[model samples]
Target: MYKARAWLSRSFTALSSNPLRVCVVGSGPAGFYTAEKTLKAHQEAQVDIIDRLPTPFGLVRSGVAPDHPETKIVINQFSRVVQHERCSFFGNVTLGSSVSLSELRQLYHVVVLAYGAESDRALGIPGEDLIGVHSAREFVWWYNGHPDGKNLSPDLKSTDTAVILGQGNVALDVARILLRPTEELATTDIASYAWTALEGSSIRKVYLVGRRGPVQAACTAKELREILGIKNLYVHIREDDLIKSPTDEEEMKNSRIQRRVYELLSKAAASASSQPMLGQRELHFVFFRKPDSFLESNERSGHVSGVHFEKTALKGGGPGKQYAVGTGEFEDLDCGMVLKSIGYKSVPVNGLPFDNHKGIVPNIRGRVLKNISGDSSQVENGLYVCGWLKRGPTGIIATNLYCAEETVASISEDLEQGVLASSSGLPKPGREGLLQLLDNRNVRPVPFSAWEKIDSEEKRLGSLRNKPKEKLTTYEDLLKVAT
Candidate 1:
């Protein structure tokens, strides 16, 4: 049996008298930042940040490109935040799956749904369901040792020509990973098993596909620059995609990264016409075509062979206004592997108001809106959101510092107005939910103690490998050694 009464202490005063108990659901930048800011703002406040994975730092651990170790330095700062005495880090506790949202509300004065987007947005093409097709989210996780990543061997062996469906920084990362040398990958936190498989990959070409023209590409200038700088990867671009002339003064203010990317891309386009790709592995950046279907190798094989596309033209205004004008020309890009990096996907937490379309808890200025009253300006208190789950998937690691600040400020305001403390914490569901999960024989979640064993073991394995660490990829392997 589980004890809620003993855990729930009425010793803590309401916001009107003192601090509030804040529970943030997710340990990503947004969640950690929120926790850090709240603790800094209030002396008596206690914070708990929960994560589904035994380890914390959601995207920092699983989403960031492993080769970019500098970017991952963020984990150190987040680790400091979690070590605060007022802060409690709960690992291996999954919301929605392991614990109901109602129980969480009863345990904390305010609950923030910061469990960032978990699913990948689709390209809606025919070959999506094929064997070689995968989402960038899954692929990145595999290389980064995310607990739920699929085995890397299957995807690595099946493709020579890979097509990625997006122009964001994530797409560039996949392209670089596909072509980067084995020596380059050894220095990062990429899983050893995944790197070993990638070292032997047959993939010779990676195409970063975008549905709009080069000027409209969502990829940041810095990502495009680093990608082109890869020594082993041959960066290719078509002349048609090269932006010809600057339109306005604002357009002329391109960042240094953008200016450098232009110089490199111009050279690539010029060479694309004269040379037959220099090396076997070519990273071609393509734009202005929308996916039509995923070409599968007969119904029996269930393997993705290629992708069909409908060439698109710009319409109306810039960026957001630029829609797929007229769909006339059609083209097919041959690809053995397909990665839909179109975007990110998230779902509403149980017992919270969710906008089905946006896949986020509905909030106004970080304040979770319970109901739209007769007067629309006012919002009910006691709930909030932070991170990707709050503001969709975008922004660099540092940007979350500001995002979390805003939510924490709103929470402070709510506390000053005596909104959250009135509700107190969520109820005690006891072991009923966990018992059901155990009955189903879902992989036994690693307890905090078990995670410590895994952590120590991983470090021990890393010492032998001459690298940071190696992770156990399988649930069976993890349980066998961890237990």
Candidate 2:
């Protein structure tokens, strides 16, 4: 009943006239941005944004660190997009499960796949499967209250040291959570269960290990600055490690952001060396150390004891072209917990042509291809891709704005060039048909108003705890609250 009136706001029987029906799979930044752009570009277009979970704002709700609330302000803009008369939001409707990609194409004129990376790149080393090892993605999801990671139950109680492999913003976020005072985190919207676990954690030192030098650090300066400023956290940056090589110096000269980050690292190292605050909670920045393997603990069977790392140095290739090559020297750093933050990779939907090697859908300028050859002639009719699914997992949240623009532009260009001309020249049933298909399957989709109920309930509970909003970390709780 809601879907019938979703697009045909004035009439219940049929659409106005030849409306361009668009279905966006994924309610994250990319999906929402695609919907917004579509609606703006085509006045006669109707857009539906859907996700697998019962709530919208995919990564903004589940991926962003709780401490970095500022980064999630984009949700307000997206809220306005779904509030548009020609747009709607549907949750609890999965593309590959509840409805197939073929089903979506038949119901709508165009279908855009924007579902983001659901898995991380594997470390592919021995002992990585040890009990204490986890991907930084899982750890972030666990702490952020993502339902999939609600029961991660990392072993924070067993050891005083935690080793994080990678130097990205995510690595710093994980490091900050492990080292930041729980009292400060309590004021944020961190999951109550996670807060309880971290409040009792024995982890006092976290190693933010990177394969390359500081100049090539993947983390932005803003993230790096925040980690260095955490109160009572003594940051360890080796003075000798800060000495940039020729390639590193060239990189810094070309990039202002890199220069600023290295300067921050240098300042932190100088301050720590001069002040020498020993025995305090520490956050170590270990560069030029590439993890070779995880060492099994003799004390605790099937658990990790430490990480075996090979020393690495930069191989010159001019500015950003440099890469790390391992040297003969090796070292071991003991730690009870390990989180590898290498990167995230997108999982392919059932009917999509995904390039397994690149971990993205095979697309050219946002047009989905029939295969991985990437030829313009192979563009799949009425199918498109955007965000991390179109490109590899990289860039910040704002990056999606530009990426979505390219996809939407392609859609517009196709419409104008008659590339999407209907063979029958007839309007699609769109949401009206989709609702019937879903009803037959007995799959109920949560609407935007229903999501508002969950949002309100979360905020109410959070107010009780003096937090921003306490997340419901289980599907049962979220669905119940929505109901």
Candidate 3:
């Protein structure tokens, strides 16, 4: 009894003397929420957030639509978190390239992988490789000035029509950007090059296609209303498509949002039938269309001309569980460009166990599991996951708050249980050691203050153009400004 008490006292003393060190990969909403909660939970815990880009605020800066700057107010909150003395931000430091997973494990007591979905799910249909076919992610990145997509230079002047194969918020975002006047977009923080391309675009009509009915739409009512509210834009919808099935009626009975969305679509369809097609631009909400393949343009050899779709209908399951099945009816719609916005997917990091089928790191309550079964006893010590990587790519920005709380709670529990204690009773190297290793590798990490320099430069450029800010679209420009 005396020996056991002595050991417990020693462990307590060691934990009190050695403050916990945490490393968070990615700087998006999930990463920031995790850091915020971690700092609040453990007063002595220090967090270091690293991102691949020189700029912070992952998807908030690059994935969100520019016209909705209100959604980006969270950046201010994240900025305050990084400004805390115990927390730090390091940008332009990639996980796989600049440093490895093993190196991060050696430096911190806990590692939280919050890097968001970096790629989009492919349609896997033929002709997807055509020049004019692009993922909604690529288009979003291009307009937002992400380095990987700034140089896309999609041919917007060749065609008068665009078809986006999804009925999600992102598809609506793409449709709005293509249909909305460039003069209005100029007031936001859209890339200057994208604005220039849009100013000369010949596109006047956009189609938002969905395989399922209106009740099964992946978009929220708010997004649907916003698109329907655009002035001088005609809406086209088949009134029959708005007719809900018995299962769909049950879904609407349970979901107020779905009922609201159905009403908005019905109202638009009614209005569209009464009004003449006299608007400068048009928006079409197409349902029950499943993409079959992309057709090659007759005029432009390697570019897409249109898409062929198989008509689909709801089958099996009830309310919120129905699936789309083909009905053997196929239709073709001619369009200049096609943007596939099915969903975003996360790639695996080295030394991490990934579930390819689900496109997420297998975990239970944010603790990464060694196998696919997600058994609680098989959790990898000191390793955790949060955000879209922990769960699949779903949820709004605020959803990450609860997701992060669960992760931080697990971390707190482990700390209390001494599951995270080092056998040597010594502290990990943390940030100071990370700096030395980075210096040795000749990789320069962009500090938060350096990012402020880039921010100032972007704002200065924006002032010249009388807008919010003109983002630097290339790594060369971003790094040059940061330095």
lDDT of 3 by residue, 181-299 (tens): 78899889999999999999999989999999988888888988888888788899988898878899999999998888888888888877555366558888899999999999888
For every model shown, what is its TM-score relative to the native structure? 0.86, 0.95, 0.96
Q: Record all residue pairs in model 3 with backbone atoms less than 3 Å apart, i.e. clashing.
A: none
Q: What is residue 345's positional error in candidate 2, in angstroms? A: 0.8
lDDT of each: 0.72, 0.88, 0.89
Q: Model 1 RMSD to the real structure? A: 6.3
Over 106-146, each residue of candidate 2 has an lDDT whose tens digit, in order, gives 98888999999989999789998999999999999999999
By lDDT, the better pick of 1 and 2 is 2
Residues 374-483, candidate 1: write the lDDT tens digits. Answer: 23355545678887777778878887887777787777666655566543433322233343543475635554456568767877887887767676666666666657
Off by over 4 Å in 3: 1-17, 273-276, 422-424
TM-score of 2: 0.95
Residue 44 of model 3 has an lDDT of: 76
Candidate 1's C-alpha runs over 4 A off are 1-19, 243-263, 271-273, 276-279, 298-300, 318-320, 371-380, 422-453, 475-483
**Number of backbone collisions per candidate, in order?**
9, 0, 0
Cα lDDT, model 2, residue 55: 92
